[model samples]
Target: MQYIRNFCIIAHIDHGKSTLADRLLERTQTIHSRDRKNQLLDDMELERERGITIKSHAIQMEYKYKGVSYILNLIDTPGHVDFSYEVSRSIYACEGALLVVDAVKSIQAQTVSNLFLAIDRNLTIIPILNKIDLPVANKEKVTYEIMYLIGCTSEEVIYSSAKEGRGIDKILEAIICKIHPPKGNLKAPLQALIFDSFYNTFRGVEAYFKVINGQIRKGDKIKFMSSGKMYTAEEIGNLRLKHISKSIIRSGDVGYIISGIKDTLSIKVGDSFTSVNRPAKAIIAGFKKVNPMVFAGLYPEKTEDYDNLRVSIEKLHLNDASLTFFPESSIFLGSGFRCGFLGMLHLEIIQERLEREYGISVITTIPNVSYKVFLKCSPTDIFLVDNPSDMPDIFNIERLEEPYIKASIITQVNYVGAIMSLCIKKRGMIKNQYYLMPQRVELIFEMPLSEIIFNFYDRLKTISKGYASFDYSPLDYRFSDIVLVKILINHQLVDALSTLEHRSNAFYIGKKMCKKLQKIIPRQQFDISIQATIENKIIARETIKAVRKDVTAKCYGGDISRKRKLLLKQKKGKKKCSLLVK
Candidate 1:
């Protein structure tokens, strides 16, 4: 235990965390030179293709430095704000963290958010400046920023370019000397924290855990603190790039336990495990389960694929407990599932995985955030609504409240005006601003989560020339003058197109949406009217003209009787079509 070091790498997206992990692996000789690959810790093909870490990967390394052998356990975590919960859980399992920052970009929004999480967990953080090989790298400015944020000295900060393999040895030496070894009671009753889990067909549910109190061995009976399910440990192993079976896993060690638990629902991340025979008196404190913030209805392109979609979602949820879904029906799209996700990126990844991995093509509705509605008659009565279609009648509602978020954006000072303009259009209120440096600034705003859920991020990136970074956390639901705007096709409401918007801007938004829908909806034999309405009152409307065939054109020189007859027939058909639309 004295020689064991447990730490994780935390940083913003595209900030060289994974690259540093690769360099560390190479320096420790964990992966042979012949088998070297880029972003080695990102095992998922989707992760590599997208150049982001979605899941946390842990590996144990044997490093010999200064003639002393050290057992280094490193966990690489996802850097996106959507997976902040994963980052927090990974930090909870480790004793220390490497705060990696890009020397050119300095510090990003996610970098600060992650650093606060580490500090809150009381973990030792070692600041490291990465990408020093780049010509734009400013070690002096970045060093000052790091010092200002983390309150560390210049000598304490390590500078390295993971791409060039510079300072890799220095980082390793810092981990061995600065980060203290994990402390635990080896003789106490077995207590382990299950930080992550995944389902395997041959082995059943594999639980990755950190032993907190006592040692675990094969054939031991363990019970989950939350589920209370007992299982005999069939295998014990550690990850050395790949799983390596071990006879015993002692305290302060991270390993996996295979208990033949085939039921995936029984296994949960952040659950504690203890000996069934000699149970620990107290369960280890674990992180909270991630709660989804954004929701969308996922319907299969074909109704027959509903069962396949259901099975696919279940299988996907086995690995991602944060994902949630329930049965939902749509008149236009048929029966489907209303799914919840951590954020927009998470929602997109799930859709891509369903289509690419499960071979199930699905149509997703517009994303929405939950709202709170208060009743006029009963002042104290309140209701929470996730779907606009489920909102109560407008006459009965007294006020509506939408979820708000505290957003932090870090970018160059030149783009501040453009960013502020965009925020104002989205009804965002500036809360605070800090000049990190003479040229860079950090802007904080209180904005509606629904506004940001749409095109806020894309627009921000565009206006800032892809130089701005953003991060946000949920705030309380605040009352607002918002109304549910429903889109109607030929007087019939399309529940899938319903959305909540500020009442004052409803007309403009409705007109824009109606015009956009007019171009997308196919023209029918009869005219189709696309209308946007609030509480049965039309706010905007657009029409897709019918494909009319000149029935009387061929009888141009024919008698007036023939022309009258053709016109009469067409008129009758038009009346019938109008009746059907009604």
Candidate 2:
């Protein structure tokens, strides 16, 4: 009999998705005392350090309550704005979702988005109000708000204190009783959804899937519909619910299969499985390609570390398929690679891993968001760019289109006046506002993503005194005044750190960033002038103020070689560094 319940845990940042998973694993005894670790499903060191789920993870557990064994497959997804696309993919793989809401903070920006995705998938939703032990948990208000927003009956909600391991059994029972199980053929042509996969050094490639229709087992030749590639399954095993003996997985069971395949290019997320003899068409229509939102130039500081960087990138690509890289060269930095990522967090994670895991020091240029430019012509053209150097020559651009985002701000009504001023300063237009509660309002705005590129969220929180919450998504590409602020030291342009900004704060931000870079540049043994120039005219300028005492006036001849060599080596060493600190 195939009795399986598939679901994902979705919540806002710091709302206890990972912590809930830990409690479930402990209650179910999936990990033995010796094998246990904190946030077991997170698995990545970076994810643990950041206290955020960067990549989605899946694990199966079996619960036997009153002699009824229920198999549960849970996927933990990223809750941040940058990982929204990945969250969508994770939602698609399951038929139900455990919508976790903090009892105190209640509904949030991502809470709405994740609920919508679950509804779109037509999945059975089980809302769990968590963290009731907290002093601020307002059960009545949060419960009422959830019912109104998600349209779930108040009786359908379940309350739990996942921290104290309370009410976990009831949550599990609700899943088995309410969530629907899969009903598909076991002997029919094979069809499975490849939700996740990883490269194993010993086993080659291991893929996990939920069989929708058909029976698959060891030694059966399988084909990936999207890539049109063939491989034979060497082994098949289900996830041990309580660290017990491995059992054979059937239809609707979440299990892992190992094959001789080694590369990730062959099998991709959203790909389907089929028998080699009777193949089924892949469901490649709705799976949108992961687009890189930010681009930056990444290079090893030491020219000799080039090989190490390449290896690091390849290893990173094993877990992150969205990352892309290409060979690039610059007159100032020589040969390097330009890499693309989903967002800032994705970029930072990769850079940190390269340094910590691979022991390679890298020089990264400023990150840039994509922009589309249209020229006046019979046929309009579109360009996707990451570097300001690639922006259309100002003279040729008739209309420029940059990505705009629909942002929502939630704050106490009393601070609405202050937040409005900050928005105006950033050139954001007010869309609308609604009363979310007695004293809270959700303010809407249509702002350029570029406007909020630099510490916009932090500033919003500061203005509201940590009472503001933000959520934004891409609205559309609209025409805007896109200007590049070029930084020049002593009248020489620095291509490495040039940035595109709204013309409103151009002068102030440019001057501040330039001053920051100049401070870090170590007073070049000579007087240096810093300037921010656009076109041929300067918008901001500052002087380094000549260093009067760099040389040792009392040094003897014997120590000249050591000191000269030291200075020469220092100059050669930090060569990748440029600009003063602001």
Please give the CA lDDT of all the candidate structures: 0.91, 0.78
By summed lDDT, which 10 consecutive residues of candidate 2 come out lowest?
Answer: 573-582
Candidate 2, after superposition: displacement of residue 388 in Å?
1.2
lDDT of model number 2: 0.78
Which residue pairs of candidate 1 clash? none
In candidate 2, stretches whose alpha carbon ends up further than 4 angstroms from where it belongs are 34-37, 240-248, 376-379, 549-582
Cα RMSD to the true fold for all candidates: 1.8, 5.8
lDDT for each residue of candidate 2 in 169-246, tens digit (9 for 90 to 100): 878888788888876777767788776676777877677777777778678888888777889877887755332223
Error of 1 at 14 (Å): 1.4
For residue 306, what is the lDDT in candidate 2? 85
Candidate 1 ranges beyond 4 A from true positions: none
lDDT of 2 at 363: 94
Clashes of 1: 0
Give me the displacement of residue 409 in model 2, in angstroms.
Answer: 2.6
Tens-place lDDT per residue, model 1, 1-582, is: 999999999999999999999999999999999889999988888999999999889999999988989999999999998888778888988999999999988899999999999999889999999999999999999999999999999999999999999999999999999989999999999999988887777988888999999899888999998888889999999988889999899999999999998776787888899998889988776477676799899999999999989978876776777888999998899999999998999999899989988899999998988889998999798888887889889999999998999999999999999999999889899999999889889999999888888788999999999889999988899999998899998888999999888888789889999999999988877889999998889999999998787999989586799989998999889879878878
